[model samples]
Target: MDTTEADESIKYTVLDNLLVDGKEPGSWGTFITRSEMYTQAAQMNGLISYLAIYIGFVLVVACAAILSIQQLSNVADGSRSYRVLAQIGCDDRQIRHSVMAQQAVFFLFPLAVGLAHSFVALKVIIELVSIFGNMSIGGTVSLTCAIFLAACGGYFLVTYLMSTGMVRAAIAIRYSE
Candidate 1:
């Protein structure tokens, strides 16, 4: 076997001593816990937690990918708009604000809608699974909302930087030509 920096061969123990590492599947990030030397189907609602987290990650990434592509297109068109606005009455700050506003709408609309869907879906999941196991609907709901909002905030930040750069470029072109 070609040994790399790390490797662990799976063994046929109860795996209760295992970290839910991807070594185990359906896990990511740094998580470590010792099981009760036994195994269960994760109490249904607990399963729901994992399901929600994974789906949230996937949905966020997919939406970000789409947003990235759409933002590229908008940047191109915004350049023209910014240049023309400059030729008219718009100043640098106004053009920058317009760039920000455009990207804001482009990002915020889908972002809010996606979070709404995630909220409702995760809430339903928690409610549905609570019948089988103890679950904190309120806590998870709030946490999910915060995380979703933060994700959107992060994307917004990135978009802001990119849009600002575009504005600078457009402004520079106007001055040069």
Candidate 2:
């Protein structure tokens, strides 16, 4: 007999013979075919993978937004400092460069720390997963890094541009008076 017939035969035999408290096996427990089990596993894996991707995307966007807001607030508070630098013979280019450098450090320090942490976590994950089978995540890591870098770079650029505008406006207001 083919596998399907064999499976059905076995299933029927088990259901007929296996009894708990004078009831069929279906009443007390669950019964599923092998194919059903595999299908359920696949569906669960897909759901977990999608959730992970979505969470990662949300975190990246949230991090960028928080950093941008913090940087903008600092610029607002330090408007007087930029004005002082301007009055003390620093050109607009020098002032802008100083703001850019400060922001670069501010943004990069957290990123460096996060990357180091991620590397350590990834190493642990790889070790654990290797027990099951050989798995390669090099391409996934590269793609993730590329996407992360692009997102962060875009945020950094926007933050820098906004900060420069604020600085310029602050200086202009002082001069206009």
Candidate 3:
């Protein structure tokens, strides 16, 4: 059946009435209509999207926490190195810049890997979705990318701030000793 020829509004109204009357397959032992099937499919898609977003947020936060802890530990362990750099005429600004750069690489590596995986997975998902209909996924994909980037940027900012403070304190302690 051609979707263009199908009267969706009428079908929606009929389906709505059927749902209101509790005449669905389990409710009244009636066969499910195409309209009802589409409704269920859309609802499931929404649920999955929400679940994915929540999981992505959790992963981003966890990544940031892990990176922050690692950076702080490295600063403590490498305090002697920073003192050596200071002794060699490296200013505090230079030391801070080096620390920030190192943290940036640490934060970006996992994000880059995750994005690579997402690109491949999204390509497969788009192909699978296209089998059902000629839907345009470009907007959805762009939005998802933007959201992920924003989360990553936020985490990077926080990690950089925390690590910078830790590095400064470590350097000061090393110099005092």
Candidate 4:
């Protein structure tokens, strides 16, 4: 019989054979074939991955917000220095470049640390998954890294734009005075 027929016919003759003897009695027990177990596991993995991606997106946005706020505050705090630099003949473009450079350095460290942790976590996942059968996570790792980098780039771009706007406003105010 095919798997469908066999699955329909599967019946446990005795509970003792499946469960350890002298165990706590329970009214419910689930028996599934290897194939069924594999299918269920795959489904669970897919669901978990979707949820993880959503959570990651939320975290990336949160990081971007925090960075943007901090950059704006820095502009406020460094207004005098910026004004001095402007008086020293630094154009708005040069000031913007300096601000972006500082922000990039601040962002890069956290990005690197996060990537390292992800790589380590992937390695662990690959090792653990190998217990069941040979599994390759190389492609998965590459794809994940690419997506992460893209997300980071998006966040960086948004933060840079927002920060430069604040700086430009500050510079305009200085020019007015």
TM-scores for candidates 1 onward, in order: 0.65, 0.79, 0.73, 0.77
TM-score for predicted model 4 compared with the true structure: 0.77
Error of 3 at 117 (Å): 1.5
lDDT of 4 by residue, 1-177 (tens): 997566646634444355555563344555666678878988987798779877887887688678767867887788778778888899888998998898888888888888788889888887876766466656765786688788778878887887777777777788799
Q: Cα deviation of 74 in candidate 3 (Å)?
A: 1.4
At residue 57, candidate 3 shows an lDDT of 72
Give one digit per residue, the lDDT tens place, for model 1 in 16-133.
3566633653343332232412124456546866797779777886787678668866877768777788889887788777767877888888877876786687778778757654
Identify the superior model by TM-score, candidate 1 or candidate 2: 2
- Clashing residue pair totals per candidate (backbone < 3 A): 0, 0, 0, 0
- Winner of 1 and 4 under TM-score: 4
lDDT of 4 at 139: 79
- lDDT tens digits, residues 1-177, model 3? 565336565565666566636556345554445766887888998798789878987887777777777877887787778878877888989988998889888988888998899899999888887777566676777897897788778777877776667667766776688
> In lDDT terms, how accurate is model 2?
0.85
The prediction achieving the highest lDDT against the true structure is 2
Of 1 and 4, which scores higher on lDDT? 4
For model 1, the stretches where C-alpha displacement exceeds 4 angstroms are 1-39, 43-48
Model 3 worst lDDT window (10 residues): 24-33
